[model samples]
Target: MQIVDRIRETFRENAAMLREIENKADAFFGKKNLQTSLMQSITMLTTRWVKMPVTP
Candidate 1:
């Protein structure tokens, strides 16, 4: 359970980090490009998480 809790915490932190990244990207790339890039990044992250092996 501890491992599961830790993974959840990490994901929460990543969510916050992704928001921060989106802010910076919005400023740098503008909304349209940011949406596409951020969506791709999120898709890749989700795919990786789906493929990850977890034992608990």
Candidate 2:
């Protein structure tokens, strides 16, 4: 009975840790995604500006 309780407690602790890690990973990726999106937008705007003909 004691061994069973120990295993159950261990599993619960591991599950909580895993959830925390997953949340952190999700947040990290979310910021990365936002950065990527902003870079793409900047690149597109720069390309458009470069392609425009210069007027005196």
TM-score of each: 0.53, 0.53
lDDT of 2 at 31: 62
Residue pairs clashing in model 2 are: none
The per-model lDDT (C-alpha) reads: 0.95, 0.90
Model 1 segments beyond 4 Å from truth?
Answer: 33-56
Instruction: Note each model's CA RMSD in angstroms.
Output: 12.0, 12.3
Top candidate by lDDT: 1
In model 2, which regions exceed 4 Å deviation?
31-56
Q: Which ten residues in a row have the lowest lDDT in candidate 2?
A: 25-34
In terms of lDDT, model 1 sits at 0.95
